[model samples]
Target: MTPAELGIGIVGLGSIGTTHARALRQVDGVEVRAVSGGAPGTAAECGWPGAVRLTPEDVLSHPGVDVVAVCSPTASHAALGAAAVEAGRHVVVEKPLATTVAEARRLAELQHERGRLVTMVAQRRYEPDYAYLKELAVGGRLGELRLATTHVHWLRDDAYYAAAPWRASMTGGGGSLMNQGVHNVDLLRWLCGPVEEVTAQYATLGHGIEAEDTTVATLRFASGALGLVSTSTATPPGAPATVALHTSAGAVELGQGEVLRWNLPGVPPPPPDEAVASGAADPAAIGVAGHARMWREVVAAIRSGGGHDADAVDAVETVRLLCAIYEAARSGARVRPGELR
Candidate 1:
């Protein structure tokens, strides 16, 4: 079928769900066939004219829906994703594909066996500077990978969590690390390669919630490189996420989603547009450009009827990484990535 025939059906009308719908709507050939608001006929109640697929199964089974975008909460991902795949629909998960690594792997394997397109949202990969950094490392111009660091120190007030019922628990909500910093976790693995082990420490110093408000973890990459990841919702004045890559030859730093510094030998400086993306302090502050960029990749995969670049085939490792950090924080012992998978 042509790209114009690719109809998108989104489940979960939350912020991410809204973001995906808006992004898909902006595309030329794609159509928003229907949306499920996690209830019966809520899609039509919300004025969705295509089809009122109030339940996820309804959307997945709808004849008009060609791709199923799972924008639901963390806990619902594996089951919902499995349902979409079982129904033979293309699947796109928001982020942190599944709460646990094992479920994530299982879901991806099922999609693979079914020959369906499936991907996890890692929007930051659309940033040109990030691509430049990865290109440098792959070209061996950045020399050996030495150290990698990512910081997501942002604040979310009580109202932010209150507005969304799934913001702080292991079920729907997760601490700063799982919910907010999972993107950076994906970036750490994508840019720095696999993580062998992780040691972590965290506490609920800032919020009155059940999860940690602050979290810091040290990583040992399989490539013999050391890494650090810091994410928190406790900082009074939230700061934009930052990432730094140190190699044997030089270093590259990205502050607020832009390249603050690049000093590798022989490689030319990144283009100016590389810094266009930035993380906002508020949850609703996300820019649609990144979402649009990532969605375009999904659309392209649908058009080709084949491969996908951002497939969550390896996303299980990132989830495993976060789980290890949480386990290490609780048990106070360095943990391997697969311990809690």
Candidate 2:
């Protein structure tokens, strides 16, 4: 189908949804035909030219909308996705796919049965440095990977939680690991491989919420690689997002954006400043743009009649691993991915 003829509907007008709408508008072959959200005037704020305000159900059922982008709350993803699929529209859902494993799996199955693309928004995958790291890992440059670690530390004040009550309650999709750390978790699995087992510890240190503000997990991968993940919403401002890999060949440290250091057999580490500058690479380092690139890949996938770049089926594994982490922390015992369901 031609880009100009693609009709897209956005199902949420939150901060992320607005970003998605803007990205869609920027894409050559897509048009933001409609928008639905609980917020007042969200559709107008989304900046879509000819966007009509409607309910999610209305957006999905609208004959003019060929693609549905589900950017609603984490808890509502599954129901909205199912609704879009039933309407015979391709779906792009934001992260966490769903709040639970069962819901994510059901959505994946339904999408498969309908022969429609159901994709998850793993926008980090489009980041240049992350993309490069994925290439290196998949290329086996991290020979016989033995250990991997990812740290995501960012600040979220009490007011931040107060802004959205659901942001701090487990029942409402709260928790640092599930909400803020999900991207890192997904990235870990994507770079390292499937996690076979998980043991985690969670704590509520700063925020007075039912959900945890800090979490640490130890992972055992299917390939015998060991992994560690730590995430917190209480860090000071400007904390670096870091991921490191240790293999037989040596180690590679990814800090900020660029590759900080590579002590591999053949690749020598660049100078310190060069390493820092390179490691501090932004998600749009190469100018492909983050969400835009992701959308482009999804559009290409749809045109080719194949799976999305970030397929819902592959995302289920990440959700499974995330649930395992929560379970392990609560049960005070190691949990396996298979046992998550």
Candidate no. 2 TM-score: 0.91
lDDT tens digits, residue span 24-115, model 2: 76577777888887466665555665888788899999889988999887778888998899899999998888888998899889888998
- Winner by TM-score: 1
Ten contiguous residues with the weakest lDDT in model 2: 275-284
Q: Give the TM-score of each candidate.
A: 0.92, 0.91
Cα lDDT, all candidates: 0.80, 0.79
Candidate 1 — what's its lDDT? 0.80
Clashing residue pairs found in predicted model 1? none
lDDT, candidate 2, at 240: 61
Question: Candidate 2 regions off by >4 Å?
Answer: 1-4, 38-46, 268-288
190-292, model 1: which lDDT tens digit per residue?
8888888899999988877887878999999989999999999988688878889898889888864556788877777677564244454688777676778
Residue 260 deviation, candidate 2, in Å?
2.7
